[model samples]
Target: MKDGLKQRLVAQARAEGFDACRLCRPWDVRHVPERLAAFLARGYHGQMGWLEERSQWRGAPEVLWPQARTVIMLGESYTPECDPLAGLEQKTSGNISVYARNRDYHDTVKKRLKRLARWLIDAAGGEVKVFVDTAPVPEKPLGQAAGLGWQGKHTNLVSRELGSWFFLGSVFTTLDIETDPAEVDHCGSCRACLDICPTKAFPAPYQLDARRCISYLTIEHKGPVAEELRPGLGNRIYGCDDCLAVCPWNKFAVAAREVKYHARADLVVPKLADLAGLDDAAFRERFSGSPIKRIGRDRFLRNVLYAIGNSGEGALCHVAQAHCEDADAAVADAARWAVLRLRRDANGLE
Candidate 1:
């Protein structure tokens, strides 16, 4: 009966829009505690202090919910239709990461998880809990344990089938489902992800320093970024996809099945001048259902100012000067830096 149920669960997961569905025991990620400790010890997490606060539950899924007998890891594909790196060349436009081009994945993935969990409860008597990156659950390690994919050198999961373009979600249940064999690493000395990093965020293979990562700086971080790292930011205003975009395995990736993951017309190449003009209300309205909204206007403007500074377009100096006295200290500092950089560029100070 459990075997039959597992088969149907896989079918249901596919029907619910998940590209991969596999199961594992809750305690499968044994190496996580040591690795996570090392990452935190080295201060690699940067401003994401919440990672340190929930160490116990994050390190051990068994302790997060002791009654769970199976962990079902799900992967939803959000592959892009075009090269994500193309926008970096558009100096006057703000480049957003491919994943945030449309609606927030958390809201979309969680709703699917709830429906799948309900179906499981109806088919078999068991309690279930769903997580879509909102909890202390170690989804990536658990995904590898469930045979979904190996965690690549970039520290994000990579599937031979899905490439590096999928989001992970999980359902933890009390039913004793059979677990799949863990996936072995297939990175095999490929350095594409490491070489493409503008900020050298990776110290070594399978390791990442979030402090120097543009995604961490533009999103998770607060205050003015370190000036030394500003030039590497380029025109990216929200998140960076350098490591993910350069993976050689992406040749196998297909276009996303969900239309909501596709790039929106305005977002594909948003003008830096237009973005810089957005006030708080305009910012909120513009990014209404998008993940970029979480950063707020002041922080978003700070990122935009940094991008303008790196653009080498003297024309944007006026935009930067307008924000020189912004109420937010970080934003003001970023504006001043941008003005100086643009003026220096105009004076041939390179």
Candidate 2:
């Protein structure tokens, strides 16, 4: 009866549009503590202090919700129809991460997880909790334990069917469900992701130093980006996708079926000039329901200015120069730096 009900739940997850569904016993992720400790010990997380504060709950799911007997892991693909790397050639254009190019996944994935959780409660009569990235849960390890996928060398979950372009969400329930066997790592001598990192953020396979990660530097780090690393960031205004884009498994990735996740035309290759001019109000209005809003106008402009500097197009020099007087020091400094870079590149400064 337990195995039959688990199968039905997995089928329901697929019918509800989740790309894949798998189960793990709540206790399965308990061994993550040692790995988490090592990651922290190496200072890999950088200034993201929250990862340190939530260490206990992050490594052990049972610590967060003891009543949970099973965890249902779900994957939803957000692969773009076009090659996400194509924009990198256009030095003047900003490269937003493929995932952030559409509506925020937090809201979209959370709503679906809630619907699935409610159905489970109604069917089995049990308490449940749902988590996206917002929680302290060690989602990647949990996903692996559930047999959804193994964590690739880049530390993101990669699946045989959907690759690494999918977002993960989990539903924890008190109902005892049969757990699935864990997926084994298939990376196998493949160093494509590591070699492709522009920022060299990965210290070694399976370990990431967030301090040098473009995603963390641009999105999580509050102050100025490290000087030496700024140029390598290029036109990437948001998170970096170079690592994920080069993965060989992505050949199987299908375009997202959910229309809401489809990339917005405006966001695909936004005009750097327009992005640099956004004030707080304009930024909020433009990025409504988008993940880009979380970084706010100042940081967004800072990133844009960095891209403008790297663009090597003299046309955007004026745009960067205008922001040199922005109210935000970070934006203003970035703008001033961009202006200098543009002038140097144009004039062939000695």
Candidate 3:
């Protein structure tokens, strides 16, 4: 009966658009508590203080739900149709990470998780819970324990079959299901991900310092990005994909099956000049359904100004100067920074 239910759950998961599905016991991620404590102790989470706020539930799934006997991990692939690094070549444009180039995965994955949980409850008469990335839930570690993939050096799950271009969703249920063996790390000698980080965010092979990470510094971080790290960000206005794109394991990745994740041509290599001009209303309208919308207009423009500064185009200097007195101090500061950098480059000081 347990075996049959597991197969049915996998079928339902794929039917609902998940590309991969696997199972694990609730207590499978045994080392997470101490690992998380160490990471927080080092202040590696940066401005994401929420990770510390919910450490107990995130650190232990069994403690999160003692009644839960099985965890169903799902992977939704969003592999970019082109080289994810292609935007970096077009310095005039901003590099929005492939993950944020479409509708927010939090909304997409949540509905699917709810659908699966409902089915599980009806079939086996057990309670269930669903989680996407927003929760303090340690989805990556649980993903590894579920035989979905191993946590690569970049600290994100990398699947041999799905590569690094996927999102994770989990369904925890009171129903016990047959468990799959955990995946073992395959990142032996390859430093592809570690070497690709522009900000040297990785402290070691499998450790990361979120303070210097472009993704966190751009999105989760408040205020202007640290001046020292701004240049390394280049034109990556949203999240950074350098490490994910450089993974050799992604050679096996296929095109994204979900039509919603297909890149909007306008968003693919959006001109930095155009983005810098977006006011609050225009920003909301432009990024209506995008993951980028959550950062709000001020923070988004702050990132745009930083990119404009790094552009060296100098042609964008006036655009930066125009925003030098933006209503938001961070935006104004970023604008001033961009103006200075561009003016410096104009004077051949760059």
Candidate 4:
């Protein structure tokens, strides 16, 4: 009976736009506690204090909700239609991460998760709870346990079918659904993802030091970035995709079917001059439905100024100069740094 229900659940998930759906027991990710401990002990999470604060719940799904018998992990592909790395060469344009170039995944994925959860409760007579990235749930580990994909060397879920470009969502239910076998690492002898990282975020294969990760630095980080790492940020203003785009597995990556995940024309490779000029109101209005809005104008401008600093275009130096006295300390710091770099470059000094 549960098997039939699981089959229908997978079908319903596909109908609702999920690229992959598989089930696993809530306790399937038994290694999470120790791994989470090691990561936190090393201070790899950076400014994401929530990860440390909710360590117990994040490491143990069973402990998070003891009543959950099955965890249905779903993957929604958001693969870029064009080369994600191409924008890096256009130094005058800011390279927004492919994921943030469109609608916010949190809203889009959660709506699907909620609909799937409601269907499960109606069909199987079980209480259900759903989560996207906002939750403390170890969605990637659960995705691996459910055979949705293996956590590749870059520490992001990579599937044989969907490759490296997908979002994870999960539905935890009281129903005792049969589980899928976990995926094993297929990344043997491949270091493509690690080799491409501009900031060298990976401390070793299969482990990430989020402190050096551009994604964490650009998005989660609150203040001015370390001077040494600023150069590695290059023209990446929002989030970096060097590791993900370099994955060989992405050769087989599934194209995102949802229009919402497609990159907007203006956001694909926006000019640094245009972005550096946006004030609070303009920034919010421009990024209304984008994940970039979460970072707010100050942080966003900080990133843009960093990009402007890296941009060798001396014409943009004045844009940085304009923000040198920004109300936000981080923005002012970034602006000063940008102006200094551009001045040094203009004078042919290192």
TM-score of 4: 0.99
Per-residue accuracy of model 3 over 154-191 as CA lDDT, tens digit each: 99999999999999999998887898999999998999
lDDT of 2 by residue, 248-276 (tens): 99998877999888889999878898888
Model 4, runs deviating above 4 Å: none
Q: Which residue runs does candidate 3 get wrong by more than 4 Å?
A: none
- Candidate 3 displacement at residue 241 in angstroms: 0.4
Question: For residues 1-350, could you state the per-residue lDDT of candidate 1 as single tens digits?
Answer: 45599999999999999999999999999999999999999999998999999988899999999999999999999999999999999999999999999999999999999999999999987999999998999999999999999999999999988999999999999999888999999999899999999999999999999999999999999998998999999999999999999998888886799888998988997999999999999999999999999989999999999999999999999999999999999999999999999999999997
Where is model 2 more than 4 Å wrong at Cα? 1-3
The TM-score, computed over Cα atoms with residue i paired to residue i, of candidate 3 is 0.98
Model with the higher lDDT, candidate 2 or 4: 4
Q: List model 4 lDDT by residue over 1-350, tens digit each.
A: 45588789999999999999999999999999999999999999998899999999999999999999999999999999999999999999999999999899999999999999898888878799999988889999999999999999999999999989999999998889888999999999999998999899999998999999999999999999999999999999999888888888888899999999999999989999999989889999999999999999999999999999999999999999999898999999999999999999999999
The true-versus-predicted C-alpha distance at residue 196 of model 4, in Å, is 0.8
Score every model by TM-score. Answer: 0.99, 0.97, 0.98, 0.99
Please tell me which predicted candidate would have the highest lDDT against the true structure.
1
